[model samples]
Target chain A: MARVEVPELPPDPTAATKVAELEVPPEIVAQTLGEYLRAWAARVRAGDSGVLPVIAGLAVITVVFQAISPHHVFLSALNLVNLLQQSAVFMVLAMAEGFVLLLGEIDLSVGYVAAVGGVIGVQLVQPATTRWPWWAAVVAALLACALIGAAQGTLITRLKLPSFVVTLAGFLIFNGVVLILLLLGPFSGYPSLLGDDTNRQVLYHLMWGTIDPLAGWIGMIVIVAGLGLALWLRDTRRRRSGLVAPPLGLTLLKIVLMAIVGLTVVAICNINRANIGTVAGVPWVIPIVLAVLGAWTVLLQRTSFGRYVYAIGGNPEAARRAGIKLASIRTWAFVICSFTAGIGGLLYASYLGGMSNNVNGGQLVLYAVAAAVIGGTSLFGGRGKVMHGALGGLVIGGIYNGMYLLGLDVQWQFIVTGLVLLSAVTIDALSRRGATTGSVAHV
Target chain B: MSDANVARAGAQPNAAAPPAGEARLQVRALGKHFGAVQALSDVDLDLPAGQVTALCGDNGAGKTVLTKCIAGIFQADQGQILWEGKPVHIRSPRDAAHLGIETVYQDLALADNLDIVQNMFLARERLRGGLLDEDAMERDAAETLASLRVTTVRSIRQPVGSLSGGQRQSVAVAKAVMWNSKLVLLDEPTAALGVVQTKMVLDLVRRLRDRGLAVMVISHNLNDVFEVADRIAVLYLGRMVIQDAASAFDRQRVVQYMTSGGTNGSG
Candidate 1:
């Protein structure tokens, strides 16, 4: 083949060298601990605050509660443990909403979906009824919730309906479903876990039981060590491959923070809390919440499915063009969301010792969304962690517990939570504006 | 009629005689219509490896339509597309990708919240044990950008939203060319870019041709077309009015063909 003789134009002299002269911002190329800190400061200034605001808010709430509560009961070991136990349901529910929220969608039906799940699990394990194994009952309940999520997801994705509207409809329908399920129960309108059957006791123990103090200490150590090792290995491997990795100091700092948190939780739980009998050990609910957090964090940060969720939330058009099955991923997100909500429902039922029609599903759903937002998860999507749910739930739980200790009414709790939710959303919006305007230096 | 014939006669020598093994893609009598509105009709285009072809046209002249047809976003209503001298069907974007054809759309189709490495390896992420292999992906993304001489980005870990307009365009182009693509179609790669950024993108276009990949650029900027294009094809309305060596036509003549569909106003 003869080469075509095309007329050659003289190369533009400036074009060949201009790009190489472009300077990369220093913070972006930070390699030391000091530089990393500076970069973090810059990011926070620009509105990518990460978890700083949430942590600071939590600290303020704790301090205020400690100062204002009568006899300073807020900081007592008994109260702290009680707070965590109460927060468990909220934390799980927030996490359930987090999955869909990260995709810029919402599942308002999760509250009642969780209640339905609890009702199913409690009814199944009733000795006079089917008397199913606790594990089997839990699985069946979660599966039922998953199916509910899938049905809602299908309507939203396949019909191209707005998630807000579809989930709102689900919320109403599931509320009725929960009511009907409870009414159909053998116990009539309420299914209590107050039976002597071993299976029933197991279901009841999920929220009310505690591990031995020694076992709690050992479990804490094992978890901390395992997580720290994983973090170290991953960062070291990346650095060895000449890729971008956090500095060693930063990594060490993170590990230390994790250890400190683990030690504090175990120590507090190890203290005697009961007024009469010996009843001090880490609550089973603590590990359950932690496990959920860990699983979700991995799904969102280390898996392709998680990546696609973020991508879809950030830019659905881009995700579609990238060949992502947007409908399928979205449907799966709803399924996961409802399934998680089912777990939360089970805990709620166990905490109350029964499933009742009086379970305010509306208030619970609102709290779930509020907790997620307050914990630093953006309602606008593409930016959240499961840890945010846990932290936010603690904040919500703290306010409720603290307000009650101060002799304040439940109305006061609602007002305070509303204020916090508004502030968090304001922060999210402001930061978004800052990011878009390039007000902060390099991100 | 006489002037149109004369212009066609002049282009015939170059258009009719692409060297045997040099033409990487050949579109013959391609036609497409959306309902009653014909978007493209009887279009012929040749994209040869080791060269850049600038497809120039006005609004509604079907420049994007032709590119999308080849990119497999839209199927042609009639005619044939020959890839490496074989008639092949392109029914979807996936099929086009499998055939080594990639397109960088006008919007860039990038998630702003994701970092450069994530956006570059969006759908085709490398995986290890069912987890995203961030290390391998980062290494490959860095290498691809380096090979393209896209040095303006601060860090591959920085979000694409943090990058300047020029850098985003560079990333988008790098992503398109990363998968060993034989043919790259860039639709208005320099649109909304500053003067310096436009120059940067044009230089990148030249580099792709130098690397022996067939590049088709849909551009309305005549200066940019002349700057980087080796072959110029002008689309008038729904038909390809002219396809010839860049040396055969000057600015005003190419404009005449673009606006009038012929050198004379008769078309």
Candidate 2:
């Protein structure tokens, strides 16, 4: 029973004699608080720092745009709130896109699928014919979107067709259905810029409605504090169970950051920024977006389904050998992607006051992919967080909003976004190449 | 050492075989065919508990076919697979796993993006309160690796992609044998390893055997076979060439049987 010198290993052993003095390379286990920080810093240097690059890029973009703008409106409470609202749809869409991206697959049809969902939602709640509650309509539309996703997933998984090709066809077909649906009714729910009375009531409330100020403050505190506690509890449990844990300092830092960001957003939205000066409260969309974001994070991090998603994305062969039902997981993934995209479509309809056949779904899908990629979700898959889309959406929205505040046209916005997207992709490619070539070993 | 010389020397040590007990898995008259091609025919072998049996064969010689059969990656067209001397049906990989059969394929079958414990408890994850019990899994993974004396990795929480080739291989093997698996099959476990890495894997293989598990290692490298194998089984052109204790033979005799199906290195 010779003692094997594994600093990370426990005292338990069977054949420790043969391994004694073998100099088994220590796993990247951090036994102490300082070592954990050092390991994390090393990982960041190794380019495994998930969303840091995207965050840094967003910061740089914000600073530059603020410097060039008239009143540094990038940091203005009103502008920031507007950024959140404007980016909310794209953010949801990007999170949806992250699923397929994580599986090393793509869904080009999500935009139109979303359109179909929105149209169905509006039609189902029509006042005269087949009036359903707003919640019911939302559910029905989501289910319909999921079915479309299942169909596409079946084509891609069972038929073994490339998702690019299948979803590209989906991109055309669903919106074609949207066009036909538009011709069927007068669509009284479509809002008139000059104030139309025929507009359905829920659409008006959902997109523009806000929580009262006191509730907003209370709600923000509860949610923020709750999330922090949940995160902290999870780590504490891991540590208590004698597993590796990040240093307490790191955990506290993360909780503090979450609180700061959450409170800041709440504070900004709580300010009265309307033209007439009476409108002040957090938009209902804010909490909705936050809820979705939170759900996506949980799905990706905690669940067995999430594990399989990463496994499939990382190595399909490995997942297959692990006896995971690759087809089922993949199909479900596509279903989830379209389901979230359906939410994005509803948001888009709400933001614009109606779904149009001419809605730039092609552009919407592109922006979704762009958001995920720019936020540090890998185009190659298996290396992204759902929150990456959240951050990326904010960046994209911030850019557009800041440009609007500077009085720039859509063309400038396009040019700047395209450049940012290009830089992000280049960064991704370079980092991956660096990883394969062992650049991270030194770090 | 000459083929006959190392054969004699290696043969003397483990002739009685299976330090733990009797054969756990026995295959008799196993036959498989892929269309007109006979991948395996009349393959008979015995894998006792607590010993390393090295399966050696030339390309297309049904060595993989046999390993896959035992691992339930493929079902034999004919013949009986007996566990503890009782005939049993092994159909899918899942069935094989249910029977405590774990195979570490040549490619390692690990998600590189995942951390160590995640990779270890991949499909068969331990759960608590309907969620992944991370603490329990981490503790188990650490214990498993330590019990196997696997200490090369700096952190069990680090992604598998960061480890060296040998470390990945070690993790795959540990994952296979950690959960009370009676039989562990490693397909070409050290096929692409360097000298030092190969030695590390061989040591790990011996450690697995000492833990009272039946380990069948597939290797083209005879030196590795000689280093860790307690028993040597050779498959030649989809037929059982020979199955004998390692001390009964050496490098040349095994290669001779592998290529020509000759007995004792003679035509």
Runs in model 1 deviating more than 4 A are: A1-28, A437-443, B1-22, B264-267
lDDT of 1 by residue, B13-32 (tens): 32223355548999999999
Docking class of 1: acceptable
lDDT tens digits by residue: candidate 1, A167-277: 899989999999898987468788898778887788788888899999999999999999999999988887777787778888888999999999999999999998998
* Per-residue C-alpha lDDT of model 2 across residues B1-267, encoded as one tens digit per residue: 123433443454555454433489999999999999999998888898878898999999999889889988889999999998889999889989889999998764898778889999998888777778888888889888877767766578867776667778999999998779999999889988867678778877877766668889899989888988988988888888788888888778787898888855321
- In terms of docking quality, model 2 is acceptable
Assess candidate 1 and give its TM-score to the true structure.
Answer: 0.92
Error of 1 at B27 (Å): 0.8
Q: Which numbered prediction scores highest in lDDT against the true structure? A: 1
**On residues A1-443, what C-alpha lDDT tens digit does candidate 2 reach at each position?**
11245443333333432232112212234445576666556656655566777788678878888899887777776777778888998899999999999998999988888888878777766665566777888899899999999999999999999999999999999878888866656654342211333335676556677899999999989988998998799778776766777656667778999899878888888888877758888988988888899888888888899999999888888889999999999999999999999998887777776666667787788788889999998888788999999999988887878889889987887888888889888887777775631322110
